[model samples]
Target: MNNFTKIQDKLMEMGASFVGCSDVEAYLPENLKKVKYAITVGVRLSDFIIDQISDKPTYTYFHHYRAVNTLIDQITLRGQIEIQNMGYSAMAVPASQTVNDLEDRYSGVFQHKTAAVKAGLGWIGKNGLFISTKYGPRVRLGTILTDMELPIGSHVVRDGCGSCRICVDSCPAMALTGNSWFAGCDRSHIVDAQACSEYMNRNFKHIGRGSVCGICIRVCPKGFSK
Candidate 1:
């Protein structure tokens, strides 16, 4: 098998259900230049516990994203060491934190959006997030940045979301960044993040903190039941 086939087999062996590598050069933010390849992975998080956590109305529940990230880190660390043996540099970057400032984010890590796009995971939805072909937008994303010049798949610029505006209609905050967000019309139907956050907080007071309402996720016309 070729290098990609070998890596794909290895990722599967490491428990990665979705694996693809993309050229990280163009997607690399200006501040981060050492990156050459982005190996992407997605773990299935569809479970009843996520709903149970929402039902409990608390933040002390198990979020599968953490486990997914840990698995990605472990696999990437091993992959990096293997790449080093092949005379190249490799590193797995951590990407499982809420943006504190939203300004310092995406500095050096490969563009998760573009990386997913090239990897044939899915198209960019109206929410400025990647939608998985198999899992839709429910799955979380992570990337490993490395100096290893792995082959990149084709760039997916065609949009699958054509005229379907369920996400646009369901966005409570109107934070969808394309037709509404790109137009800079943030004062109208636009949801107030503070207000939206406060609403979640209010729900938390009654049920659970940081519970995912998933109205938008449910309303989305991708894969999965609303």
Candidate 2:
């Protein structure tokens, strides 16, 4: 097997629900073409998410974000170290990189999502979400940018959402109808960040409060509860 395959297997054994690699070159967002290599990382969610829910101030959903960030941090550090050992220059890019750079230094492309989809980790669902076999759409993602050259993987050719509209029908913000073209804002059918932001801004009781109503997550038959 190639280094990419070996790394992918190693990641899966390390507790990753899914793993994939792609040639960032092909999908190079014009702004980020300077990047020679891109690594996409993802972690599956568990019922641990349910346990972190609260009705208190700020309605913290800490475990989910924490778990995701932890995975991203560990995997990124490990990968970067390995790259350097192999004589390559590598760097970790936070999700915030897109925001920090804004233009020349960054690409509008969300690296994690792009790398994941291109690696065949999942399909870009009609809901505009990446749906993987083990986690459906319940997962957190991150990416790394490097100058390392490695074997590439194929993109997920089949969409898991053959005919499912649960996400569309379950959107509380009435933000979904179809694909990214009509479904909702920012390419997610289940989330209307705008409506949610507006609601959270105006309403007092729930304006700043609990679990962010994951009705779509709860309703997805293919999704995992734990």
Candidate 3:
């Protein structure tokens, strides 16, 4: 198999639920501009656990969230090593990390959704989460930025949520703006990050140190079979 297929196959073997590549030169920050391509990975979360989430996040969900993030980090690290073995430079973006110094307190070093969307994986939801074509927002994403040219995913999926507001009305924090997300729109247009963070910190600090609230993921009907 060629390098692209080889890399993809290895990531799949490493437990990635879905994988895709995209040319993300336009989306990279100045420091990351050297790597013009991105390999995005998504891992599906437990339906049983997510379904149990109601007005508050459960301890089980909190543990599951951290476990998934750890798995993403491991898979992305392996992906990075595989790319480097093939004589290309690669950087694995952390599965879940907030760069507090950035102007956006809720932001990370890079937005995995940016690469995932560009890779034709999914569209951003009204809840401000990546809605994977196969799993909706019930998935966690990992990314590896690379300089190696690779096959890019096409057929970008459009917003599947048309007039649906379950996630919006279900947000305990009332942070969702009930606005549909379009490409190139600011995140602030759909959700208030400050409000969401503050609410979580105020009410759920005992759960996951106020870092997680999966009510939106639980109420989303896009990926539900029931």
Candidate 4:
């Protein structure tokens, strides 16, 4: 009925698995502090492609990964345009772009999981990935920060990965720290980014150019449970 509902409905119609909104003022940089709200969009990855992963990423998985990221970008861009048409300011964060200038080289302009968690769609997994309540870690996220005041999700989902170390044990890079994620906890506590990056670059260059490794996603019990 309202603008938020209209936008959310449109995004879901565009193939997004989930669409959520949250107040993310505290997580913004000074330049983006004006856009205090975030719209979190998630697309569930293919079970067939994800299942193909064992110890390393497959060529098909790499292509699938890029395709999903591109899809997320398109969806968020359309969402951003819709918000602007509604007389609000919006910026679509890239689905997978890394900036070397950031304090964390492995991160994007903003963490999609942060917004997704605040939106109550999911929690951060031990693998440092967003584990959707419905889809587990098999979902990729996109975000659109805006000045619009949208209704936020009330139920903040807690870490459901209690004692699950399957992803940790399965990581060939040994990048996972077996640490559970809590709101506001640093990413390093859960993953060794440098180690993970180096291992992938060294071994999986033929697949996704070492940019992707879905072993953790494949071994995650949460995704296969439902």
**C-alpha local distance difference test of each model:** 0.60, 0.59, 0.91, 0.91
> Cα lDDT of model 1 overall?
0.60
- Per-residue CA lDDT of model 2 for 103-175, tens digit only, reads 5332334557667776767666545456666677677677766676666655445666767787677655565
- How many residue pairs in model 4 have overlapping backbones? 0
What is the TM-score of candidate 3? Answer: 0.97
Worst 10 residues of 2 by lDDT: 50-59
In the range 1-226, model 1's lDDT, one tens digit per residue, is 6665776677779877688877767656665567667888766555443344322322422345456667777777776676677677676666454555555432333446567777777776665556778766766666767777777757554667777777666666554533432222332233344544555666554443443444445445675645
lDDT of 1 at 225: 48
Clash counts per candidate, in order, are 4, 3, 0, 0
Preferred candidate (TM-score higher): 2 or 4: 4
Which is the better candidate, 1 or 4, if ranked by TM-score? 4
Which residue pairs clash in candidate 4? none
lDDT of 3 by residue, 130-217 (tens): 9998888999999999999988757678898899999999998899999999888998899999889999999999997998888999
Of the pair 1 and 2, which is ahead by lDDT? Answer: 1
Q: Give me the runs in candidate 4 sitting further than 4 Å from their true place.
A: none
> TM-score of each candidate?
0.72, 0.72, 0.97, 0.97
